[model samples]
Target: MKKVLLLLMIVIAVSCKNETKKEVKKENIIEVDKNYFPTELGKVFEKHGGINTWRKVQILSFNKGEEVHTVDLQSRRTVINTPKYSLGFNGKEVWLDEEVAGTYKGNSAFYYNLYFYFYAMPFVLADNGIIYEKIDALVFEGVKYPGYKISYKANVGNSSDDNYMIYYNSETYQMEWLKYTVTFNSKETSNKFNIIRYNKWKNVNGLILPSEITWYKKDENGLPTAPEESATKFTLPLISQVKLADSFFEKPKN
Candidate 1:
């Protein structure tokens, strides 16, 4: 009887140890997932609006001059309409319709989501398949801004070789500037980076979004020199929890 009792006690102890180990392991995994983003960039996302909040967004729309651009946040379907022309990506191909307007001039594939990516900034950088590295600080005028360099994994996007650098105000943790390389339609990557300044911002549905973005002329070293006379600006920014129907982004029939 004594031997049997001892054996039973030993078995209970071992089972409890195994259960405790499992619990600890599960907690460690949750911690890792919670902290997947680098510390600094994580703060940026929080300041803009938590990354999780941005992820929950189903649709986002904004206006650039007379053009209304709407994007399906989850599927990356996009549609842009102006008085003269309309274009969109139906998840598979980029289509342009100028029947009511006129002829379209720019490359449809490249321009489809260009502004959306730019407007979405720091939050978009949190997307999967992106690798982030700490980079040197950028000193513009007299202010010093810290930044991170972002690159995509192989076969991630239209241009995986393209690189982006995001600079933020260290004190506020708000993104202030962005530098990106144009590798579209190129087999090889380029080192030249064009800069855009994000100074004006507004809050829409708890997310910090750009109201006006300034483009600057590049110097000999390809860094921004002076603010361009014509800056790309946005208005009527909105975020929706409801996604548009798939047919909304489909090619228009005419």
Candidate 2:
């Protein structure tokens, strides 16, 4: 009877210890799922539209100023159609309407892509190769905004040299000011940075997008110390289109 009691006590202790360990593991998993795994940018994506939703969307269509832009988010394919020029990239290849006036090969491809990228915010920043870090609240236009700095690993894209500082509203978490380096040509990380203020935003199919994006050139000191104080660069009105066919991005036979 004594031996049986000892064995039972040992079994009970072992079972209880195992249960406690499992509970600890469960807590750890919950914390990781909530915090580190998703990332700060992931939180922003959830605010706009969950990454899964954007991933499920095969195509995103929009208009910026005079051009109609359609993007295949999954395939990374993009099409920019304007009255003057049409450029298409099927994720792997970028095609431009050569017969149309003022279409250069890589230049057109780069420009079309750059425009689309800036227009599609928050989500575009959620890309795989991006590294994000929380930065001190930015003091802009005499107002303060919570901000984060985003950089890319080498070979992230055509220009990994680029870096972005994005500021968000403290209460709403919507984006406000964006400062980015335009180093598309040089591999060096040292490049002049530009600023764009997100004046307004609109929601399309659950995707939060900027409606009016105002550009600002850095001051003579090469930094945007204040809002709208620097020479106002060209401001573009952004628009959105929806559900375009893949063939729209394909080259047409002239």
Candidate 3:
């Protein structure tokens, strides 16, 4: 009886030791996988250019259906700069030119430029705004993309009326496209504006910038209407004559 009892205690000790060892091994495996999390790609995007860099841009808008209006947009310090100045004009008359002393009043084109500027900073901004989920994996233009689907509630008073879902390209660590509906004060709602592709990634002072961006806009039924439009083009001059002032973006008060 005594011998049997001693054998039972020994077996129990051995079983407990094996269980502890297995648990430690499992934890180590989880740690290794965590290192490959997709959010880390934001650091890569930042290394290229990211959203932190400030730049001046020219935005050209064309009427998709009719040939009535075409506009030029001049913006300074798209992201960080506050009280941003934008000058706009339809091909013929002055639509919006708030920068100059004798310019026109506010209009829809002015509001459009403002919305574009806010979307300049992609990943970091989204992380702060809402929840993100890993969506799928995709490849574009020979680049691999591990996709992440993001959903968030917009801030009160934002033009984006509904909750938004944006898909981020994993390999590039940038947002490829997003879908959302917007409500304007005019009581009109449109579900247009989808980013299709990012082209011409150029390095500006160690920051990779997509000089050309294309997106889609569809009508209510979601039919492919117009071939997407290239949103903006930034031409960085090798040498410049005019000195850029720190207060360039500030609105000159009357």
Candidate 4:
């Protein structure tokens, strides 16, 4: 009886040891995959709000001009509302409802999430299928800002040929400027890049987001020449971890 009791105690100890080992291994795996962004970009993400926190967000909404734009971050479903018109993407289709005849003249498809992508910034650049490369610094007013060139895998989106450059303050690791090429309806990619300066930021739900973005006129060399008078500004930025129902983003019936 004494020998049998000793063997049972030994077995229990071994079992507990194995369980502890499994738990440690699981934790290590999560830590390893927690951050896959490049060192500098990871710092930028951490400075804004950790990438893990951004991934937890379900809904983001803000006002652009008189239009109120809301997006489902996970699904990419969007709704833009104005007194004159309502436009939205119901996961699969882009729809428009005009209160006034011919009120919305913009392309519904292209304009759906255009500003959302721009406003989301560095976080959106961390999306899947993206290729990142460290690039030479950008100098503006004698201040050198390091940056990264972002490209996408073939067949990634509507315009996979599109390219983006993210320039951030070296000391603060905060995004300062963005330069991108528009290839939305082009067969061949162009080297021409348009620039947008992130002039102001506001914190929403612990994430630092653009409150104002200024478009700059490009010089003959495809660099920013001067800030344009008309800048895109945002207000009432809100984020929620709770997701909205699909019906909310669906096309509305007349």
Candidate 5:
């Protein structure tokens, strides 16, 4: 009788342990499913209309490295006002403010005159179907951000250098920083665009916008400092309407 009772008690204990383990497993699976995975960012981009199209942007830019230079520019500052042309600027330089004149002169000037076209990938990622790679998490100002490294590649006939990486904050889903490499005359130069720790996202014409932006180059410490080469800020106006022709995206004639 004693032997039988001991065996029964052992069996009961084993069964109860197994049931507890199963419950723990079930809870773990639920937690995994509940996580805000990086894939959800793709959905957010889709909901925001997939990048290539954004109207009315306001940007405040700053330079990194030696001295922190700043600018306050608006998009409507360079309105061409012609049926075919319009121009925009960021205080220091013109971004895209041109009307399709008899020739594609403004288009050419916009590309070669300023690096605006080269640096437009951050904004174009939504419309051009940008791809994201999971990178390390970024911790800033006491907040831990799940980071997704972002990049873009050009399609047929688009010579714009779209190869660059951007870091999106995990919690806010806002772009926190960008790292890019550009080749000039066979020499590759790397740059980082850093956010100076601020909240307050602005919505512009159905799209979200980051009001402040700063540029920096990665340093030996693996942290962001001010960028020395070229930096500027843009303050966009309230753009109620935009009428860009198809030719605006084409390359200018030689």
Candidate 6:
């Protein structure tokens, strides 16, 4: 009886030691990931509407004229419903309702999910593998704004080199201008950026989005202004019917 009791005690002691080692290992992993969590960018997300609230949202859709754009947050699938060309992505390759060939595939793929991402501000930027930095407000057009610059690490969607600089009004905490660059071939160099102003804003299903997005030509000093050639570069007026379900964004079959 004494020997049996001693064996049980030893087993219990080993189990406890294993648990402690596991807990310490888990804590060390969390400590490593803590650096990647952008606390400042999280404040921007909370200001708009907490990231947790946005996470609960399953589907978000908007209309730009006759075109419709929808995204499934859970699966990260996007669907662009358009009169001319419709697009669907099942989280991997973007499939089209019609068979696409040549450079059209690249063009279609680039444009299919582009504007939807723009319209889905703050929320879309909260994706995984994104790195954020709080920078000094950019002084432009005789005005200044608090800024957050976001970039993607490796394995971030199709393009990893793309960087976005979002400026927000300090008092209102509303996004003002978005400056992003297309570093297509070169993964490291970003010498130029096109700045677009968020002209109008509207709240849809508790998420703040830009309704009227206008493109601007940057001056030598990198100030954003309304382009002389165009009026409204992008418009997403019909913003409603936010729902959930990954099947909605899947490639439609006959």
Best by lDDT: 4
List ranges where model 4 is wrong by over 4 Å.
1-33
Instruction: List model 6 lDDT by residue over 17-60, tens digit each.
Output: 65001111222221112333344445556666766667766555
RMSD of 1: 17.3
**How many pairs of residues in model 3 come into backbone collision?**
2
Worst 10 residues of 3 by lDDT: 19-28
lDDT for model 1, please. Answer: 0.79
lDDT for 172 in candidate 6 is: 71
Q: What does candidate 5's lDDT look like per residue over 72-101, in tens digits?
A: 123322222223433433334444333444
Report how far off residue 176 is in candidate 2 (Å): 0.7
What's model 2's lDDT at 6? 34
Distance from true location, Cα of 229 in model 3, Å: 3.7
Worst 10 residues of 5 by lDDT: 19-28
Which stretches in model 3 have alpha-carbon errors above 4 Å? 1-119, 123-127, 136-146, 151-157, 160-175, 178-180, 184-193, 217-226, 237-250
Q: Which stretch of 10 consecutive residues in model 6 shows the poorest summed lDDT?
A: 19-28
lDDT of each: 0.79, 0.63, 0.37, 0.80, 0.38, 0.64
- Candidate 4 lDDT score at position 153: 95
Q: Per-residue CA lDDT of candidate 2, range 1-254, in tens?
A: 22223333543464466500111122222122233322444556666766666656655555665566666676677776666667778767877875556654458656768866777787777776876666667665667776677789989988887888787787766788787887766668864667888777777667777777777656674445545553222223222223345565677667
Which sequence of candidate numbers ranks them by lDDT, best first?
A: 4, 1, 6, 2, 5, 3
Provide TM-scores for the models. Answer: 0.84, 0.73, 0.45, 0.85, 0.44, 0.73
For candidate 3, write residues 1-254 as lDDT tens digits. 22222333443454466500111122222111222223443444454464334222232212212111111223222211112233332233223224444443355343534444423434233334544454444434455444444434566333434334344555555555444444555434454535344544555444454455556655554422444664644443121112233233332333
Count of backbone clashes for each model?
A: 1, 4, 2, 0, 19, 0
